[model samples]
Target: MLAVKLPSKETIKVVEEPIPIPAKGEVLIKMKASALCRSDLHRYHGKVLFDETEEEANITPGHEPCGVVEKLGEGVTKVKKGDRVAIYLGLGCGICPDCLRGDVMLCKDFQCIGFQKNGAHADYMTIPEENCLLLPEKMDFITGALSTDVGGTLYTACKRLNLNGTQTAVIIGCGPMGSGGILMAKGFGAKVIAIDLDNKRLELAKELGADYLINPKEEDVLVKIKGITHNTGCDGAIVTAGGSTPLNIALNAIKKRGSVALIAESNKAQIDPSNQFIRTLNTLMGCWYFNRSDWEEIANFIVNHNIQLNKISSDTFSISEAEKAFPLFDSGKTQKVVFTWD
Candidate 1:
């Protein structure tokens, strides 16, 4: 089998490796589709997020993986051979209360697959049977891979915001996650306004059915959003870009009593509690991964609405082309990039 390994900053190498064997209560998956996430960029630069004692970078970097089960180890009964599945990124202690509830990411001892362990970007990998979600028959590998993070996170946010046709929403980022949010907001009938600094992404947002597009670099975001809402304000906003500016924009642009979901992670921000939040009764939430139950709903929605998951990913490379794929994704010239194999 062949796999990708990042040994240093901005470097990717493909190496030959033996296929992994499943352990008790685990299943061996033959890789099919795996998408590159923005977080993976941190790994590319040799910044280790999970392990501190390790001297060299060794983990394969892909968390969004969809593949087919090839072998089932002892105690694995949830799925069988030949089953198509999407691997949940979180790996929590099985006995923990949060793990029992299927919110593995909440476990105090949880480990992210691509961060803490050898992940996809390999020809074969092993995971506990419990972490695999059965993919719908009609869903392709690309959509299956995306549903875990891109679709799941946005769907969870939409649920939190109570998005509907009667409301107007703003999405502050035109990356893959933001684009996915636009599709979800539109599917739920909300009028979506997408904001970004990049024109290419803004154009993609427009094509994805965003009612309006705003480039903050070119115009005052507050003025544009207010004008679009007829001097009122949006019913809700989602900030997917990591920064204080996007956070500030989301805070001031929504209508009174409206909600804002911050899906991005950032350390610095400016906010006025007395005026921008308290006076307006604004509801701001920090959203992370979705609940286990959200998977089925998200997949069904994608199928029923004919949401084109493939549109979010602009390019796909075989396992041998892993080196070429990373640089393209790193350049920010593409939305979602993936690796696939027969």
Candidate 2:
């Protein structure tokens, strides 16, 4: 079997590896589609922030993977062979309280698939049966792969904010996650303002139903958002791009008591609680992966509203072309790049 490996910075190597057999409580997935995410870029650059050792660099870099179950191990009853499923990124101790409740990402012993173990940027990968969610038959492989991460994460964030028709939301960044945020927010009936420096992504958001689009470089983001909200500020904001500027803009653009969800992977923000936080009584939170209920809701919403996940997809490549795929994705010139197998 051929698999993807990142042995050094800005490089993807396609290597021959033995096809993994399913272990007890696990199943072997025949790779179908594996979407590239911003998180994977960390591994592409040889940075493994999640684990203790540099040895974690050896893991294949892809977390948004979905495929058909090729084989099931003993004790694996959650899914059977030939079932199409999307692999949940987190692997956790099943008995833990968080795991039992389906918030496996919060488990103390959590291991992220792409960072801590071999992932789906390959011919085949094996994961615990409990981590495989059944993909809807109406969903294609590309959409199913994205539903596990970009769509799932944003959908979870929108759920937390309780966004609705009477409110307005400003989504910063307009990358895949930010774009997904726009879709989910609109699906929930909120008037969405899509913000990004990238015109292509902003255009995609417009087609996805964002009521307003702002490029911070072209127009003052705060001014435009305030004007759109009639100086009261938006009801909510989501920052999907890292940078103190976007986060601060989100904090300043929402109305009093408004909620801001931070999903970006940045820790360098300098915020003053006394001035920016306490006065408005605004709620700010860092959000990540979704719980099982949130995933189910996202799936239902996509089916019900006829959300087109592939609208954000840029291109597809085969496992053998991963060498070309990673650098293209790394360039920031494309969106939702994925690897597909026949």
User: Global CA lDDT of candidate 2, please?
Assistant: 0.87
Q: Best candidate, lDDT-wise?
A: 1
lDDT of each: 0.89, 0.87
Q: Write the per-residue lDDT of candidate 1 for residues 137-196, one digit (tens) a residue.
A: 899999999988898899889989999989999999989999999988998899999999
Residues 1-342, model 2: lDDT tens digits:
998888888777899999999989899999899999888888788776677256777877789999999998989877888999888999888798998998999999988988888888988999988788888779988888988898898888998888999999999998888888888898889999999998988888899999999998899988898899999999899999898889999999999999999999996988878767899899998898888656667787887877788778888999899878888988888878999888
- Residue 102 in candidate 1 has what lDDT? 75
